[model samples]
Target: MVELVFITPFVTGLLAFVLPSALSRQLLVLTGAVHLVLSLLLWKNTPQAWFAEYFAVTPEGLLSLLVISLLFFLISIYTTGYLAAHGLKSENIFTGFMLLFLSTMTMVTLSDHIMVLWIAIEATTLASAPLIYTHRSGASLEATWKYVLICSVGIAMALVGSLFLTFSMELGGVTSAMSFSALTPVAAQLDPAWLKAGFIFIVVGYGTKMGLAPMHTWLPDAHSEAPSPASALLSGVLLNCAYLGIFKTNKIMVSAGLSDFSGTILIVFGLLSIVAAATYILKQTEYKRMLAYSSIENMGIIALGTGIGGLGVYGAVICMIHHSLIKSSLFLSSGNILMGYKDRLIANTGQMAKQMPKTFVAFFAGFAGISGFPPFGIFIGELFIIMAAFKTGHYLAAGIFIFSLCVIFAGFARQVMAICFDTPAETGTGPAADGKDVSFKEPPGMIWPQYVLLLTSLILCFFIPDALYQTIVDAVHAIGGGLQ
Candidate 1:
């Protein structure tokens, strides 16, 4: 079952390269459905990987797999319609890369060995590179180059971190397998200095890929330049895959009684990322780029929550889940807005409610959810995180967190109001291309996916299923996280 989760997509991706464009698009959706179903089955039964040393269904892995599977499926649907409208020159390449991207992320989630995880993450960088360059424009080419180069360097650091982890095992004279499951019980015996160094390197390496501050230089460019579906995957699930690596390593650090050491680093980096994102979001001109900065801010929040542990870790899990849903929905809606306006600049967009009412609903609701408004999972997640911070005597950090949230909300709200209510004429911007002739009705494929994602976020806010709630608790428990 574990093999099937990735193998299906791998095979279909190869087929996409050879098949006609039309058939390849269908293959993409078919593969997504199969992958999602297989992932659900694995979650239901908790199957072992065919290669236990390299892969397994840990609770954390299961949670990531579920998000990747569901998001890919919905995004694939959006892609079919997206491709039809955009009329790319090489649709087959785009389709193939998307499938391969899915396979690599699945591999990241299931990987247990440190080296194998590094390899899988590196593969994701390679697979998604072409997708960012899909437009083949000068700007996209630059974005793709920066993405590949930065991520490759970061993944190399992760490889070094893996080597350090192996050295830690050797220094302690432990003969156990180097897989995460095998190491946790004996983590106390590992050399603390070596283990702490390994954790630092792992966090830096994977944090770069996760869009944490000081190492997130490539994210805004890559996200703003990539196609909307690709951007959705990058912001929604790819960052989570990187975070899974850090999360797993932090678990090892906790088991080794270095929680303070690891947690402090997480909190510091998390705060920096939020501050960095808040600065740029206030001045952002492009809507897609604004969303990219939002991704950075949310990543920071997740890191902050993970660092605080206890209820904070639970809150991080909730935030991770909801951010994927809401942020991806926003990116897809940006696609709709791009399609209608043919412009990416926020100042060039206006009267969304009058011009594109369907997209307006999805876009505005996504904005509300992301701003941590009521009836959305993010609001609950942020609330828990704030309370947990106070409980943990992190009053200064909590105060900073609240201030950052307000600044981001104010910036995001200002932009959203202008987009939804302000008329182009009033803003001194001319009408959009085809503004007078184009129908207001957006394609169901493009619009409905966002609706479904937002609705799921809403429902989860009100009620979570017993199985899922348990899964969340189990995932957090590995890192000393609990309700108390």
Candidate 2:
């Protein structure tokens, strides 16, 4: 299983580069099927799975691999239909990079060494740059440039942190061994000063990539400009990759007796990210940009849950899964809308339901799911977060949480009303697209993928498995004391 996964993506990536468009897409879809099947087989054969020095599955790693691989498969299916509709069967760069992204993510999820994780994570930033500029539009080029520059610099700090972590081990008279499971046992013996420094740098580095507040400036621009498929991968899968790095490190921190330090940092950034989203979403003119802010808000909530610990971490895991599903659905549906027509002001696009009812309903429903509607996965996750806040005696944080959530809902709802419901013009106003005639309906290619993704998210809400939640609980338990 390990060799198949590890070798398949790289080899297929090269094949994708040379194959005809039809063949390239076929290769991707084939790989996706194999991954989906392997994921299922792994689920049935669940045990302490390992591949020498290269890959291993802790409980957390297993879950990460499963979710990411499954999500990648779904996204690839959507990409196929999406590109074909646009008459772009598959460019060499496009198919090659898709495989590269998959390979990078697989490397990240399967990595046992902390340094290997860092390397794989950085590679994502590099591989995704071309995907961002795939359109070759000026806006896309600018966005891609910013993404590369910012993420590259952020990842450099992660490298520095990696070095510090290595130095801490060396100072403890430990050899260069750096497997997570292996290093974790001896974290307590590491030097306090060096370990603390390493943790801070690591957070700063990964936090940038994770779109944590203050350092998250590039996210909206990139998401708004990139192709919708790439945007979906960025929000739905890439952020999770960064989050996993933080999770692994925090696990070590807890063992080294650094709970408060790590927790406080997470809480501060999480709250700031939420606040940033609220402020941005209130008047975000661009529909795609609005979704970008929504991603930031979701990332904030995830971090908030992680920072609070105990039940909060478990809640975070739920939120992570829920957010991935809903955000991708939302972005894909938004792409449906955007491709049909382009506009900055939501008010300009009118009566979406009349034109593309299926797309409209899917977009609205996705928004509702992301906004924490009842029976949706996010609602369950948020409910857990609220419960955790109360249990931890954090009345202020709880109050703020509810208030911020309400504000976010109101802001997004306002936009939904404009784009999804209102008439095209305000009274006797001009056309939605710079006074040019435009269509209300989205293409079939666009609508199908979104519907599939939306239904998948809704399904997650219904089948909330105890085993899944238990894995999260175990992962959170590992975060206890943040490597104390």
Candidate 3:
């Protein structure tokens, strides 16, 4: 019955492919609502999967499930408005694939078996591929191929890594079930050499999907080319699904007393990602692409925090939740800007305060939140991470983290100001030049989802619900990570 959380979406997705366009659109929202209710129910009283060998719930997975559920629901409402305005071709295809994307990501969060987790992650790449190509532009086509090809290669490596885990078990003469829960207690008895090798491959593999550096090339292109709603899901929750894979594997490594090895690698990768984003962000042109790089930077921060452990893991989990909320809202707001300006470049889309006041509020607030400004959960999360890094004696790494954040914020703020307030020259070419023109009418549906997401993040910053706070603590407790 717990599987219904994903199954309902999967079934409706298939039906969406054949249903009439109008009905399919309605089905998308309906599915999202139903999925959210089911996810809440499952979370309320953790239920065992019928196929316990392949699926089960944990604190981490439940946390991811709740985020994915809420995001998809709000995004569904926004998509209904987006589709009507854009009148995209193959609406049915878009609806169906979006639902499928949700289902696959849900499965990834719930998967207990290592191979099953890999399968679900790979399925997410496949399900989201069509969504990226929905625009059907040459650029979109190219981006789709890059996403599929790169992610496919990365996931294949993950498969090999999963096999290495099993091989470690075989070499040690331990015949436990292949589930994470089953292997973790006996992980210390497995071959450490093979376990280390497996962890390396798994990190590089899923790290690609999670948008970590060196493997994050496909991410910007995919996010930039995908429709806004799809972009929301991609940056918002899809990356978290991939991170869950690494997190679970890291948990096993800690149980095996390989924490030092695993932690160091994560820290290195985390800093690399953050530094990489800073380099590109300073000279970025496209707004959506800028947001994409920001995601890479945030993922880096999460990795760094997790690697630091103790308070750091708690901070990383907080960053993960806040990032999902804020980034998704930013992407949705970008859609409004895209609709009004008919351009992706910040230079051409100036004077948003006058052209799209409502969107400006959401977009600018999201900008502040994402940049670690106060009154937002990310500010608290970042603060915790910085303090944790210092407490762990990662002084150099902490310096790099703080410096990169400053650099990224400076570059990001400059572009945002141009987008929000700069007046265009009287060239009669860009929309901003024509002071009287307002291309987008600012739909209530599109406007409100973003506000809701940002408001939720703001509320959580001041007061996290007791259950959610406990869940966050529970998630990190296994790996020598907790508030206490």
Best candidate, lDDT-wise? Answer: 3
Ranking according to TM-score, highest score first: 3, 1, 2
222-241, model 1: which lDDT tens digit per residue? 99999999999999999999
Better candidate number, 1 or 3, judged by TM-score: 3
lDDT score for residue 215 of model 3 = 97
State the TM-score for model 1: 0.98
Tell me the deviation in Å of residue 460 in model 2.
2.7
lDDT of 2 by residue, 383-461 (tens): 8878887887867888888999999999999888888767666442335434454563465656676777777777877
Q: Which stretch of 10 consecutive residues in model 3 shows the poorest summed lDDT? A: 424-433
Q: Mark the regions of model 2 whose C-alpha exceeds 4 Å error after superposition.
A: 46-51, 88-90, 426-445, 465-467, 481-484
Identify the superior model by TM-score, candidate 2 or candidate 3: 3
Q: Total clashes, candidate 2?
A: 13
lDDT of 3 by residue, 1-484 (tens): 7788889999999999999889999999999999999998998889889999999999999999999999999999999999999999889999999999999999999999999999999999999999999989999999999999999998999888999999999998889899999998999989999999999999999999999999999999999999999999999999999999999999999999999899999999999999999999989889999999999999999999999988889889999999999999999999999999888877677888888999999999999999999988888888888898898899999999999999999999998998899886454356776665767999999999999999999999889889888888899896678773
Provide backbone clash counts, one per model: 0, 13, 0
